[model samples]
Target chain A: MKKLFKFEFRKLLHSKSFYIIFGLGLLSIILFMILGRVMSDFVGDSSEMYNATATMLVVLPNSGIASLLGTYLVLFACSDFSQHTIKNIYARGYSRTSVYFIKYLLSLAATLTVAIFYVLFGFVFTLVLGGHVASIASYMWANLALQFLVLVGMHGMFFGVAMICNKTGVGIIVNVVGIELIFTLLNFLMQIAKIEFNILDYYLEMILANLMNSQQLTTAALVRAIVMPIVYAVGFVTAGWFVNRRREV
Target chain B: MKVMIENFQTNNVVETENLTKVYGQKTVLDHVNMHVAKGDIYGFIGKNGAGKTTLMKLLLGMAQPTEGQMKLFSNGNLNAERHRVGALIEAPAFYGNCSAVENMKRFAILAGADDNEINDILQFVGLGDVGKKHVSKFSLGMKQRLGIALAMLGKPELLILDEPINGLDPEGIKEIRDLLLRLNREQGVTVLVSSHLLDELAKITTRYGIINQGRLVEEVSATELMQRCQQKLHVITDQPAVAAKVIKKLSPKAVITANENSIDVVGITVDSAKVTKELVKNEVAVQDITFAADNMEDYFIQRMGGKA
Candidate 1:
């Protein structure tokens, strides 16, 4: 298990696609920060509100989380199937369960790695840009932690999708299409049943999209942020593992 | 010349009992019982989509058999016993963007081979001086060599290769044939290889298993298949007339025909040793003895029931 895990992690670490996605993510961060800075000059906002550090922590994810996360999931989670490398790994005596976990865990690690690099890069760039670092960015640890769970949870949903698709091009198309319709899938169910409850708030996409905006950190919201994402992570992982175990590849 | 028959012990390296695979409504494999002994270059012959790759998948643990059982290294515990097996099924699959060295290193680690084994394996496959060239830049033959290199890792006792010489030139095919022969001769490794080039397979194979439409029609050794395909024995001697008379005496019921220095003995298997002895007694020196064998492709096609 450890050998397979290390091999899987190294595969992504050495891949060109991983680095390309990381560049796109960094570009999204830099572009959003510059755009926010230019708009602040005309909106008459103070420097403290649109500070670089604050943008780094809060806006980094919200700006490009969907596309960036989708691309990562599409490439890493299922590209091996199209390359047929997973068949080689299986022929080498690794079990189906072990391969599944290695891929899933490495996907999680890659998401965290890119997210941390963006945050740190934004922090350093604020200093170089001669912008005052806001104290609120330092105290935004709770929101940051919540957003991390939201990201992981969102990854779990796409991880399942990628596993079932098992083709990179199809995975990309399905992931992009799934993200577009996922928010309203449950709402459609609720409206057809004539139910008044808005179940969309509990979905991974909804929670992640609204994570930094609703910074109340209420007890119910805290439980929802913590419990909902973990459930999706566990639920989707279990489902995907079974799907992989029965597959011929 | 053929392999020494004594080395072929009954210790089966690979055995399948009534194995079957069904995909949807189509039955891909139907009750195949394959036997590969310890020192055999077992050539599995079949046309496209004839369950050659499916059987390989089951042996590699890449797919579950729908019915029946398979044993590797004579052990029923396939997962544990599979560690002793290596394979190159269909095309070589690798991270195309990575260098050949990097790709080999990655699979070597996963296969539990020592890092020191890398250079030796790459050199064995004639890819020693690639110098960090990416696999995506490699030609089809180079990629096939890399795939073979990957299979040679971890000291596998049994190698299962499917269509290994598909894209190679004639020289490359001969090189691979020599490699397999060397491995079987020097290391006593058992090889299960499939190829469309029946002539190449006939040169190296010690045994054959012909499959047609998901059924294993036959499993026979090279010597036995040759005997079944023999047309007549041709003998060369100093005096063809005397040799023909001697061969006629050895097999009276056979038809003997002679040319300037050679005699053809048809319709029977004669004692060539006795004929050689009698020819020497008659002062007609025996030079060479051989049999006109049938084309291996025709024989295999017949074994496959004229399917391909």
Candidate 2:
């Protein structure tokens, strides 16, 4: 199992697409930043959104991280199936369960690594755009940690979709765009009806939004933050593992 | 059961009893009892969709057996014993975007082989010089060689290769044939190979297992299959050199080769009595003559035709 993990991790690291995904994300950000700079030339940088913390808030979700990360996770997980390389692994005597979980652990590590990089870049861009850092706060650190968890939780969803669908073409569509569209529609409908009691509070997407946008963390928000992502991480991974194990090579 | 397991541990590298696999509404493999003995290049012959890949998949644990038992180099511990096996079933499975060495490195790690073994394996399969080339750009033959390189890792005790030489040129085929022969001869590797090319299979296989419609119809040694499939007449004589001269004079186009004690005449139209008479008329002194099927492809076609 350790060897399997090392080999998979090595493959992931060696993948040019892995770094390309990150580069593309950064390129899009650069282009968007230039547009924002041009727009600010007339408006004169009066807004408070250019600060380090506020820039992170505006860019992390909107920076194409969600979609990019979603697509990358699906691509990574389904490459074994899409390329049929899993046959080699299984033929080498590694159990299906071991392969599934090793891939899961690798995906988890990837999510956390991307999340850290995104946050760091968001801060770096604030300085690039000539904004000052905000005063450090304990609650802010907690919020950042919770948001990273939310990213991982979402990564789990993408991983699950990839494993269950077992093909890059279909899995990427479903996870990166399809599932998010469904959640967005659900949120839209809830608003049109003006329903007070929200069922989506326990969902990762909703929790991620609430954590990213909330000014102060409430007890209910804290509980949802802790419980929802864990559920997504564990629940999705378990489902993916089961589906992958029973799946034919 | 214990006795059978012990017997196979020494005598056979693979033994399966009543091994069956069924899809949603169709049975792909129906109760096959296969045995691949040690040091055997076992040829698994079958037409496409005739369950050759299905049986290979079942042996490698890529698919579950609906009803059966298989022992691989040991008793019941399939996972442990599977460590001694290397298989490449169906189309070459690989990361196309990665270089051959990178892909080899990836699988070699999983296969418990040292990174140093990668160069030697690639060289053996003729991919050593082009190790840095991405597999996507590779021709079908190159990819096939890469697949073989992957299967040859870890010095496995047994190899299960299905149609491994699909897209190779004649020279490539000969190279792979020599490679398989050398591996078997030098390291005592037991190989179970399935190929649509019966003639090519005939060249390297030590024994044969013929499959028709998910059933192993026959298991015979190479010599036995040749004797069974061959229709050429072997004319034993006191002077084989003289017999060859007379046969060449009798028919210029006839493939007549002289053995130490006999002249093998390969042709369907050659009558034994006519050859015997010709050899005797030339004072060649014919002692005996016999005829049988002379082509593996012809025999296989007959077999498959009979099954059909």
Candidate 3:
């Protein structure tokens, strides 16, 4: 077991894709920070509110939060199959279960790292520009962490899709198509079902809106968000491993 | 000179009992019963689509046999043997971004390699110097070498390689050949190498199994195969009628297959020079003369009802 874990981690660390993804995380974090600082309005007493709004808008729309997060996480998860390196991973004698789990953990770690980095830089930028550091810092941290959970969950959903469509090209196409078509389709369905949850538009849109609003997360809401992603991750991972083990390579 | 079956030890490292693999209506492997000795270098030789890879996969537990049983033995317990087997089937693919050393490190860990054994095996396959260099830049031969290095990491008693030298150059092939030999001879590793290169297989293999279409036609020792190929010499002469008369009178057991002017004669013991001299003395024209025992390739062709 120890040997297999070391092997998994070693492969993950040595992969060029891993480095590329990590670098992309860092670059995007910096890009978000710069955007936050430039667009921030520091006028009179309302300067803190303006800075907070600017940071929320920049992070949520472009970097720290929603649509961008989903894309990055999905891309990172699918890159393994895209490059056709899954065979290499399994041929090393590690079980399919272990491979998928390790990849899940690695992607989680990377996403969290990016989330934390973006929040840290956002703090430094806000302070230098004469914004309310204490009032907004906590919100920023909480929002960033919540956003991280959502990103993790979104990754799980994407991972399931990846397994369902094993080919990288198909996975990408499905995700892009899902993003473009699902929102409207879900909205229409929600009206027909008379459901108030508004899940269709809430997937990426709600996450984006919350980032900009600095809305406090209720315990139930937080649990629902966290648990929903876990369900997707576990379900997809099981199916993926099952399909992988049974299919002839 | 066949492999003596009764005298062979019963402690088999790998045994397949009536293994069958079918793809829909077309059977790829039909009831293959293979028993690889604990310390034998079993060479699996066959033409394309001979189910060599399928057999290897079944043995490795990568693919389940459609209908059969495969058992591994270790210390008289089958379960213990599962952890001891190591294999590399098809091409060895690695994460292109990682270095060779890193790839080995990963495989060594998963293969249950000890701390020192990891680096030792890397050096064994000549990938130690490729320390930080990513695997993407490594050539095909290098990847194969690394693959072997990974397979050898745990020092498995059973090593299975399928078409291992597919893309290697002459020097690379020679290097791998020597490495395999040393591993088997010095380390007591039982190897199962499947290849189409008969000459190369004939060099280091201790045992041979010939498969055709989906059935294993023959399984014999290397010594027995070499001996069987030495059955008789073939002679080609310019004058058919005269050469036939001379060969029949000299060696009654000899058979002749003649064309318009060229003739093929088998079963004569005389040297080529002596036979040529005798044919000329008898007024038979000798256009070109060549005599040698049939090789494994020839024997395979003959067994498959094809002239070689």
lDDT by residue for model 2 (A22-78), tens: 777877666666676667766887354466765565455555666777788778888
Q: What tens digits encode model 1's per-residue C-alpha lDDT throughout A1-249?
A: 887887887788787878887788788777866666667777978474346566555655545766767777878888778789887888877889888888888888878877887887877766665677766744377777788888788788778778877788887877777656765887898899999987876866666666556555567666788899888788877888888887987
lDDT of 1 at A42: 71
**Candidate 2: CAPRI quality band:** medium
Each model's TM-score? Answer: 0.83, 0.83, 0.74
lDDT (10s digit) by residue, model 3, range A75-139: 55556556554544444445556666776676667666656666555555555656653444565
By summed lDDT, which 10 consecutive residues of candidate 2 chain B come out lowest?
Answer: B299-308
Write the residue-wise lDDT of candidate 3 on B80-160 in tens digits.
464566666788766677777666666666667776887787777777777688888888998888777766767788788
TM-score of 2: 0.83
Q: Tens-digit lDDT track for model 2 on B85-107?
A: 88888899999988999888888
Give the CA lDDT, 0 to 100, for residue B25 in model 3. 94
| Candidate 1, pairs of clashing residues | none
Q: TM-scores for chain A, candidates in order?
A: 0.88, 0.85, 0.70
Please list the residue runs of candidate 2 whose C-alpha ends up more than 4 Å from where it truly belongs after superposition.
Answer: A27-59, A128-134, A187-203, A216-218, B1-5, B230-295, B305-308
Clashing pairs in 3: A3-B109
Candidate 1 error regions (>4 Å): A47-56, A131-139, A185-195, A214-220, B1-10, B114-116, B232-249, B252-295
- CAPRI quality band, candidate 1: medium
Pick the TM-score winner: 1
Give the deviation of candidate 1 from the true structure as CA RMSD: 7.3
Ranked candidates, highest DockQ first: 2, 1, 3
